[model samples]
Structure formats: structure tokens, C-alpha cells
Target: MQITGYKSQGVAAAVDLVNAVTTVEGDASFAALREILRVNGFFWHEFEERDAEPLRRWGRTLREFFDAAELETAVSLLNELMLELPMHPHLADHDPHGLHLHFAPPTARLPHRFRASTLMQLSELVVQHGLGRTGTCAAEGCDRVYADTSRAGRRRFCSEACANRTNVAAFRARRRTPRTPEGTG
Candidate 1:
């Protein structure tokens, strides 16, 4: 895939993974982690007993990207992460999807790979599209994070359901508004 395609995919996967970690209840079990990794195109192997902590830390860092108060703040946070958790970039074709760039070394641990790839991709995305592309849902009572990949870059909600619900609520509120006493004025 093209670099932009790869970056977009990575941002999407990162968002999904972060959201799952933050929104999902219960402890981060091996099965849950495996499922999240699988959905994000990461191959899951037999996880070590201590793997959950690193994954949680990674998720916390990823969540910070979305929770940033402004674009510059988000960029700064990402840069700080890049400096703290460096990734050794090297070419590899381990996947059947064909040759693509890999950020971490082949022997890196799963948490390291997850952190490196997602953070690198997120940095590229922010550099290419600005930190405004990442945001929380605008719908009431829904704070899910989403990567705004639309061409127009006007996305406001995390999902269509939230958008629809917000719209419907607004329409109902407008209809219920009282407008009268014009002639008395």
C-alpha cells in the first residue's frame, strides 16, 4: 500500500485500539488484548503473563493523543513520546500483504512494536493532516475518539449514530421551543 494509505490505516487501527482499551470494562485479559490486536491487523502470539501492563501503558499514551486540548499540545505530546520511546526503522516484508515499512525491529516485543508503529503513524498523520484531524465525538454523552479522514475534514462525531442522535435531539428541541406574543409587541 501507499504511504498515505498505510498511515491512514495505522491511525484508524490506533484509534480503534485506544478506544477499546479506554471504553471497554474489566481488566485487560489476554483474550481481550488478542482480539483487539487481531482487529488492528497485529498478529497475536502466546502473550507473557506480564504483557498486560505494557499494553495498558501504551493505551494510556495513545489516549492522551486524543485528549489533548489543542493541536499544538497534541503535536508536542506526540513529539515527547517519539523522543521517549524511540523506534528503530528497518525494511521488512513479514506480512503477506507485500512489502511495507516497519518501524520496529523484527525481534522487538509486542508492546514495543505496538507502541512504535502506532506512535510513528500518528506522528506522520499529525504532520500531514494537522492535529485537528484527531478529536473526540461532538455528540452529547459520547466522548469517543476518531480520526477525521474525510476529504473535507469536517467530521464532528465518532460515528453516524452519534451524529444522527444529536441531530434528532436538536430538531426535537427546536420544535418544542415556544414562539408567540408577537402581536402584543
Candidate 2:
């Protein structure tokens, strides 16, 4: 839950957003990052009292890009452009917060931060947890990604609803298949 500093926070936020998008059906249909961030608080912008419309639109756009089938390609190219190394910066204290290394500029355009943070976190996930942990929901018709944060990395479906639905469907399939009188294979 609690990541160490800004770098950690940024990476965590990226992972959280990626996981959130992957679990739903389609390559990229969901666009609820603002709500997700409001609940999770990825950046100080979300906490701003002035106006959050800009942030909301930014979040939506990020989701749209994330949903793009070419996301991997884009991230790879962006990573090259940003020149990110496989390193985590040390925590340094900052305004209104404790020690934290600013992984990104607070004033930077929303898209820049969004892409940078996402790519960085995804790269971290691949290195730290292995790409095996990043996966799609097992339920058919559901195309959301799953980061497997559960105790057992065996999480298949995006949610309990999908899990239940898949299980019920499996049970029905079994019932529909005529049994071979127990003696024959």
C-alpha cells in the first residue's frame, strides 16, 4: 500500500492505473482514471481546490492512449525519448510533504507525466515482479489487465462478478455436455 517516496508513488500510480484498465473487456474501453486517482491520490493536482476539470480530461485522455493497441510500442518509444534508466531516485523532502524524490515535474503537461509515470512503473513491474504477473482477466469477454496484487498471484478475473460469472458458465457447460455413462472415456 504505502510506497516509499515520489518515485515509488509515481511507479505505484502507473501500475495501479495499468491494472485498472487491463481488467475490463476490450483493449481499452474504460476511462475512469480520475475517479480512480481521486480514490487513490496519485498526484497533488488531484487534490487541488481550484478546478479539477483539466485533470479529469487529462486522465480520460491518458486512458484512451493506454487503451490503444500500440501502447507497448508508444511506451517503448517514449522511454527512449525520455531516456529513463532502471534506477529509483532517493527520497528528498519537498513542500507540503516529507522526503520524496520528484520523479516528474508537478507543472509538466498532464500527458507527459502520465506517459512517463506509466512507462516507468510498467518497466518496474517487469523488472521487479516479472512480466508473468502482468496479465489479462481470465474471464472470457473481459479484456482488463490484472496486476495480481492478491496474496496468491492467481487472480484471473478482474472482479468477483466476472469470476462468479465464469464459474457459473463453466458449470452450465459441464451440465450441457452429456455424460458418458461413467464406464467409457
- The top-ranked prediction according to lDDT is 1
Q: Candidate 1 has what TM-score?
A: 0.85
Clash pairs for candidate 2: 22-144, 22-145, 23-144, 23-145, 24-144, 25-143, 92-100
Expressed as tens digits, the lDDT of each residue in 26-111 for candidate 2 is 22223455544544445534443333444444334334333434546545644564574233344546665676444456665554
- C-alpha lDDT (0 to 100) for residue 151 of candidate 2: 43
Clashing pairs in 1: none
> Model 2: which ten-residue window has the lowest total lDDT?
21-30
Q: What is the TM-score of each candidate against the true structure?
A: 0.85, 0.58
Worst 10 residues of 1 by lDDT: 1-10
Give the residue spans of candidate 2 off by over 4 A: 1-32, 44-101, 106-111
Q: Candidate 2 local accuracy as lDDT?
A: 0.51
Tens digits of per-residue lDDT for model 1, 45-71: 645657767887787778888988788
Model 1, which residues run further than 4 Å from truth?
1-4, 24-27, 46-48, 179-185
